[model samples]
Target chain A: MLANYGYSDGSGDYFITIDTQRCNACGACVMACPSQVLVTVDEDPNDPENDGPVVVAHGDRVRKLRYECDPCKSTANTTMPICVVVCKTFAISHSW
Target chain B: MSVDKQPEFWRWDETNWVNRDIEWINSEYITLGIDIGSVSSQAVIMCDGEIYAYGNMRTGSNSPNSARNALEFALEGATMKESDIHYCIGTGYGRVNVPMADRSVTEIACHARGANFIYGPSVRTVLDVGGQDIKAIRCDEKGKVTNFLMNDKCAAGTGRGMEVLSDLLSVSIGEVGDRSFDIEVEPSPVSSACVVYAKSEATALLRQGLNTNEVLAAYCLAMAQRIWSLLERVGVEPEFAITGGMAKNRGVIDRLCKKVGLEPMKTRWDTQLAGAIGAALFGYSLCRKGKSKRR
Candidate 1:
């Protein structure tokens, strides 16, 4: 299941998407996160039956991604965010 | 001092320190660390390896001015000037904007290192409740960060949240800690995690005939709970120590320690200066490395 974190604004729609099905709950994403924007939940938000808890973006950070992630987003060129790059499971993706 | 009468709930009146053990002239290297945070700023000057002078002040509107003023306050009454400092490292939110700093470091790294010095090598966990955020850090003996967690873009579990309650209750910021413990009955924690909603919750409790102290106690408990969850994410291990503005709030610290079942490591220095102290120590190492490399 895909769960999206972030909001739409005047500029455009931005999001940090987490695919729980693809995640293995390895916690690499959580450890690699510099800002602690992602955390491991006890139970999967997207799947109650899955039982395997997974990492998801912080609730407080979900709304302010555009501002909070301004530093990580490369304006000069395209580059994956640290959270996206570090996730070996390829369970995370960002839209801008 | 500004003649403003708004009750300065955000104000934390405290003095800076300068260790007398070091003589600036005799030291081969003099390095400085400036931590410019959202609510406060600090500057620490180290002569050779020991602390020489330091300043702590409320941050101003402009970060550059705040950094300069904090350093100047530390340098006050001393013969040394800014020009005499060999190197400067800036840390915290405004680290990049420090006009005088040679480089900048993250507050997380700086806090861990500072906690190491203040609380000793046993501090495996550090919970820093600064102006707008809470950080839960796990560091090794050398003060290197191994793992950490931080609250994201929220002021709910930080110094700003306490200041909001202080303003709402018409109580001085310094008085919040002592007044909270004065309440006879332990109130339930406030329901809301957001500061705005928490204010309304607090107002409702007050209208429900709770005394001001009772309401304050409730808020402190709620604040402790909010940060406690963040600490859980990092998986707390002792010896634990706390740093930043919230460390001064004994009510919260005592409750938090009780909730977590660990006694915090003690430190005589101001907890708010942890990031600056860490940055200064980093500067000391950097200067020492430079001198050794040159030789």
Candidate 2:
């Protein structure tokens, strides 16, 4: 399941897609996210049947991604988002 | 000195109605459901699984106050008092902010349950186009969500986008639907994926000698198309039902139905209260289950 979080507004689309099949509940993405946009939950809120822990975009920050992720996207030194770079499974991607 | 009241062109009606046939006082359990959505708020009061009364109103800046106002509006002219409510559940974007809610449920689950009650057991697909988001939900006969997808990030397919179009064209929100149909030829939809760009495109069309109604038709068509793509991703099923503010708009609904080749199931109750109705029903069931557990 490709869980896409965030929204498209008048400005543009800002989404964080997580491939749940590859995610192993690793907290690396959570720790790497400087804006605290990701969290590891015991259950996937979108998938009620999944009982295992998985990483998901924070609910509160989903709507405010443009602002919350501004620091990382605006910096020239960073080649990629910290969360995407740190994910060993390569299950995370962004649509900006 | 009293200032002259200004007319709010974009304002929709807010009202409450009670089922006079139900004698709520004698009911063993009375449950309340409050839905504090981004654009509107609703409160539903149920007596023994039957809808006793419901109030629909525009959401205020403060969610707690909005919930309180909606509940008070529903209780107005009724024999029941706040103390009579045995259980309370809240749903919607501001669900957690409801001061009186004993529990909170997701709007996705609440809408499925509420649609089952309002549209009947045959309903399998629910499309809720709310103020800031669009949700396409598939549910079982028992109103349990089987699968669901939600898009809250964009304003292109939402009520907020419609409101902006209405205000831009100086058309009342209620008349946008009917007036859109009045145009002789349906213009191609506005060529923008974002509401901001669409607004500018609408202004350009107006400059190019398009009438207000014609411009409205184009925008409505775009909105319908935008929503249709989302529904396609979720796979629409038979006995489809639409809830929330968009349910009341025929301009988008009619076009979308024509494109999808399926008419939406109708409901007698106000479509905006679907979330609240589901919340109240859930509360009632929880109360019953809790009672049985204690025994």
Candidate 3:
């Protein structure tokens, strides 16, 4: 599913955009990101365990973030990117 | 007397009847109570105004039968026969499935009664953290249940959550409470509320070279927070008694106490037997009432 969209680093700039409004904090992107860039924010003070931000893709441009991502690209040919494939709420997507 | 002259039925002597009645009263009889909870089953036997025997065992997937087995084991340990028991009472999630029980009671009522029995009449609140559920109940001066709140929809704050962490850490569940005492640094936070997601989060932390104790301590803190939220919603009072399997987890209890700003009242008596003990007490009280009415 993630491979349907192609990313090209036209200007060598990198960034991954996530729409927080659409994010349900389901953690699909955190698990799918091969570089371990995404992190979930922990909100509750009483709950020290559950207090952190989720992991997201790292970079400034959509193409650089998505195309140069070696793990997802390598796995994309034979298998769907884990984050995009497992997104039950469709909260995440590569910007470019 | 001739065979024909023998009475068809013999009449009992009043003196002999009274003597037999006295003997019956003197002989000790054991009554069993089985509590089949979501995570565990407990059996207790009350004999002659004392607790003769008791046993605790995991409920596994089949809870009803597990309760029966626990009861049987307790009876065996006490060197008593099942048929010798006068009555059986059942309580907890799978209480209704205890085929041998003459009656079944709710865990809330049973826990209140059990705590009240152990702690006397002063106890006002009971916090029961079982395998799959957490309950905070209030009681009146007479130990009657007032209002209560429960968290059964989620496994995040229950014994099952600790079990998951225990498996992940490759440590026994019994060690989790004591091992967490030495944790110095605050663990890297785990952000997921879901148990499955929490496991992944713990794994991620481990991959990052986080200490296992730190991770375990964080898990305990999270569960305490979840439990505290539920307790706060119901309104907690002093002299609060904790019961159920998770009550044995001192790490969680200590964190919860700090979060709630009050120390919980606990007893040497097994918390897991609270339901069964309460049921037996209720049964005994009812039997006494019946005798008084006859008199």
Stretches of candidate 1 off by over 4 Å are A1-96, B1-6, B291-295
lDDT of each: 0.80, 0.86, 0.64
* TM-score per candidate, chains pooled: 0.76, 0.82, 0.65
lDDT of 1 at B73: 94
Per-residue C-alpha lDDT of model 2 across residues B1-295, encoded as one tens digit per residue: 9998856667889999878889887998899999999999999999989999999999999999999999999999898888888889899999999998887878887898899999999998899999888888888898877656678767677898888888778788999999999999889988864666767989999999999999988888988988887777658889899999999999999999998889999888899999999998888887787632211
RMSD to the native, candidate 3? 20.7
Name the 10 consecutive residues with the lowest summed lDDT in model 1 chain A.
A43-52
Query: For candidate 1, lDDT tens digit of each residue in B1-295?
Result: 5866665665778567767656788888788889999889999888875778889998999999999999989988878888888888899988988999887777877898889988899999999999877778888898877665555356776888888888888888888889999988899988755676767988999999999999989989988888886677567998999999999898788889988999988898889888998988877886676632211
TM-score of chain B in each prediction:
0.94, 0.95, 0.85
Point out where model 2 deviates above 4 Å. Answer: A1-4, A8-56, A64-96, B1-6, B291-295
True contacts kept of each: 0.00, 0.22, 0.00
Q: What is the lDDT, from 0 to 100, of the residue B232 in candidate 1?
A: 72
* Whole-structure CA lDDT of model 1: 0.80
Root-mean-square deviation of each candidate, in angstroms? Answer: 10.1, 4.4, 20.7
Report how far residue B143 has shifted in candidate 1, in Å. Answer: 0.2
